[model samples]
Target: MISKKIGLVESIASKSNGLDDIRVKINGEIQRAYNYPKLTGEVNIGDEVVLNTTAVELSLGTGGYHFVISNLNNMESNFTPGGHIMKLRYTPLQVKVDAVEEQESPYHDAIEEFESLENMPVVVGTLHSMLTPFVASYKRNNPSKKLVYIMTDGASLPIYLSKNVDTLKNKKLIDSTITIGNAFGGDYECINIYTALITAKEILKADVVFVSMGPGIAGTGTKYGFTGIEQGPILDAVKKLKGMPVAIPRVSFADQRDRHMGISHHSLTVLNDIVNVEVNIPITTYEDEKLDVVKRQIETKELDKKHHIVYINNKNTEEDLNYFGLSVRSMGRNYQQDKEFFDAASSAAYYLMEVCDDSRRENY
Candidate 1:
C-alpha cells in the first residue's frame, strides 16, 4: 500500500509550467510539496491536500519533495482526447495518447512514409543538464538549423518539471519537443523512441535531434544499476534506424567522487560494456592533469579502439552560451566550476556542426 498523508498548504513557494512548489504542514511538521495544477486544478493557501509521502517517508532521493495526490477542496477530474491504447495502464492517472504510430492517429501516413532518419545526427546524453549546452552551442554555430529534442522516460516522468527545457524553448534554442514512453507534457506525445525519432525527421523536419531524459537521474552507486543505462539501447535504436549516433560523454573534474571524475563511470560503463554499436564519442581539448586521467581511462577501457573517438576544440562554448544568454549547472556546479562537463557536451555539438557543414558542401 502507498503511504499518503493529509497536509495543509501553508504557502505557495513558486509556480511554473503547470507545477506548483508549495510549503505544507503535515502533523505539525513543515514539508516541501509539488502540486500539478492540471490534475488537481489550482491550489491555494489554506487548502487541505492529500500527498503521496511514500518516497519521502523512505528517505528516498526523489528531490526530497512529496507529490500532491489530490486536494480535498477540488475533486474534479480532467480528461483529454486520446487513442484507445493506454500508457501506465491500471494506474489512477493512466492516459491514452494519440501515438503517431497508431492506425487512428492523424500522423499515421507520415509515420508510414518515413523510411529512415536519413543519417540525421542524433546526440544522445545521459543527463538532462547536457541538453542546454549542446542545443545552445549548436544553435549559436548554425542558427538556421532546426533542432528537436526527444525526451525519454528514463528520469523524471513529467517533462514540465524541467525548467531548463522551458527556458530553451522560450529562447527558440530548440525547435520542438517529443516525450516518449510514459513521459507526458511536451509539444507532441509518442509511444516510443522510434516514433519520436520519426516525428523529428518526417513531421518536424529537424536538421538534428537531441535525446536525453528529463531530470533527476537515478543512481544506485553500483555499476550497471543506474537509470542512465538506457543510453546503451537508445544508441542501438538510432543505429538500427540508420541515424548517425553522436554520444555525449559525461566528463567532469569537479566532482569529489572518484567514480564521477574525468570520464564518468556512467559514460565509460555504457560505452565500453553496454552499447555494442559503434558511436562517435567526442572529447574536448582541455589542458589539465584531469585530461590525462580521462585519456588513461579511455585507453584502459579500449574505448579508443572500439568507438570512433574524435578530438574537438570547444574553447568557444563559453562564448556561444554567453551569446544566447544561457547559464547551465550540473550537480549544483556552474560553468566555471564544472568546465569539462559543459565542454564535453559542446564538443558533441561541434562534431555535429562539422558533419552538417561537410554534408552541405557535398550537396552543393
Candidate 2:
C-alpha cells in the first residue's frame, strides 16, 4: 500500500537531467522529496504536488525523502514514447524505453548479428557502492580505455537515483552507461545483461564494462535471499558471452553482522554455488588476519576447484578515489571504516586492468 499527501514545493534543492531533489511542506512540516520530470512535469516553488509518502511513513531508507507523484501546478505530462519496450511493466508508472535489442531500435540488427564479447574484461560487483572505487582503480591505469557501466535491475529501477554514477561521469571515470533489465535513464538501455554486454562491446565500443546494481540493495536475512545474488548470473552471462568475468568479492570487517564479517556470504554463495562458470575471483592482500579468514571461507567451500583466486594488493583505493575527487561509503561505512571492503573491490579492479590489457592485445 502507498501513503500519499498533497504538499507544497518549498524549493528546488537540486536539478539534474531527469531528476529533481526538492523540499516540500507537508502538514506544516518541511521534508525532502524527489521529482521525476518525465513521469510528472517539473515542480517549481509554490507548486502543490502529490507526494508518495509510503517509504517515509514506514521509516525506510529512502534518505527520509518522499516521491512526487504529481505536480498540481504543472499538470502537463513530460513523457515521450521512446519505444514499445516497457519497464515497470503493468505498473501505474510503467515507462517506455528504447531497448537496444528491440526490433524498432536502430541497433537491433547489430544486436542480432552479435558474435561475442571477444574476451572483453567485465567486472561484476555485488553492491552498488563498488562502482566508484572499481572505476577509479581501473581508470587510474587505463585512462584511454573506455569503461562502460552496465547497471542491473537488482536494486533501484531508475538509474537517476545514483549520485555516484553522476559523480563518476562528471570526473570521466566511466565512459558510458547502459541500463539493463528494468533500470532506466542510462545513456543506453537493454532488455537484459546479455544484450547490454553486446551493446557495450559493439555499440558503445567499451574496453571494459562494470556490472552492478544501482542503490538500495534488499536483504531478507536468509541465505540466497539478497539482491546481490544477481552477481552470480551476471558473471555467468559474461563467460557465456565469451567475455572475461572478474568478480569483486564483498569483504568487510566493520560490518557488525556475522554473515558479512570476513568475506560476505553473499559473495561466497555467488562465487561458490550460484555461478557455474569458472571466473576470476580477486581478493585483497591484508597484513592482519582478514586474509586468513577470507581464504578459509573459500577453502571451506572448496572454491579453489571451481574458480581462480587472484591475490591482488590494492591499497591505493582511497588515493584513487581522492584523485578522482569522489568519495564512496557502503552500508554507512567510509573507506577507512571498511578498508577491506573497498580494497577487495580495488583488488578486482587491479586484476581486471591486467586482464583487459591482455584482451586488448589479443582482440584489438
lDDT of 2 at 157: 81
Q: How does model 2 score by TM-score?
A: 0.96
Model 2: clashing residue pairs? none
Report the lDDT tens digits of candidate 1 across residue range 6-33: 9999999999887899999999999999
The per-residue C-alpha lDDT of model 2 at residue 178 equals 95
lDDT of each: 0.87, 0.87
lDDT of 2 by residue, 48-159 (tens): 9999998899897633569988888888764566678889899888888888987878999999999988888889997899999888888887899899999999988889
Question: What's the number of clashes in each of the models?
Answer: 0, 0
